[model samples]
Target: MADITAPELKQRLQAGETPTIIDVRETWENEESRIDGSQNIPLGSLPDKLDELEELKDQEIIVHCKSGGRSASAKAFLTQQGFTNVRNLLGGMQGYQQS
Candidate 1:
């Protein structure tokens, strides 16, 4: 899976490169704060929620969680599920907030 840094992602978004951003953090985490426009799908529910992401299979998907662990797992799972353009937001939202 591809790995993208927070600054790179920010630049891409600023440049109008609107990739699908998936937030794999839990509901509580999402309630606390999240990147605008990111789709929230907690890591635990992803397997059952595959259909929700079907349309994104062929697109550039950026997965992220509180840090990077959950997103890494999500990236592997998406790859196994045949998503070719999956990527993990390196350091996740925490890194983005820091930046």
Candidate 2:
């Protein structure tokens, strides 16, 4: 997967599709606000948390950061780790806030 827009992702969530939403922001950033049901894992700790995501490797994953940059990196890292269905949330939470 390439990237998913906030509206599209929100629709998918409302429809109950269980794609894992990974928030690759720092703890303070996450505490400020985050997508409901998203997993909080800072970008730097992603490598250490790889095992935590093992079972989700086969599932679709939607990653987001404050403004999309970190999420893009997260997407690349996940792809390298053999996650077949990973997507970066375009525009990240800022986009979500808009709609």
Candidate 3:
């Protein structure tokens, strides 16, 4: 899936589309600022949480972090684990805040 820009994500949220968004930053980072409704699942804990997310394997899942690096890794990892539609949030939280 193509990565989603912060503006696009904001638009979707405004339109009342409940996209499945995953914040891959650490708990403290997520607590600092976050897109409302996005799930906080730090990248390091993803493997252990796979079972909880199994139902969403074929669904669209957006992942983001403080910057873009960790979420990019999260996207790659999820895709490798049989997730068919995984997207990274471009520029991550920084971009989202800027937008």
Which candidate should be chosen as best, given lDDT against the real structure? 3
Clash pairs detected, candidate 3: none
Candidate 3 regions with alpha-carbon error over 4 angstroms: none
Q: lDDT of each structure?
A: 0.91, 0.92, 0.96
- Off-target runs (Cα >4 Å) in candidate 1 are none
**Model 1 residue pairs with clashes:** none
Give per-residue CA lDDT, model 2, range 12-42, as digits (tens). Answer: 9899987789999999999999889998999
lDDT of 3: 0.96
State which candidate, 1 or 3, has the greater lDDT. Answer: 3
All candidates: CA RMSD (Å): 1.0, 1.0, 0.5
Q: Tens digit of lDDT per residue, candidate 3, span 1-99?
A: 899999999999999999999999999999899999999999999999999999999999999998899999999999999999999999999999999
Worst 10 residues of 3 by lDDT: 28-37
Error of 2 at 24 (Å): 0.3
* Candidate 3 similarity to native, TM-score: 0.98
TM-scores across all candidates?
0.94, 0.94, 0.98
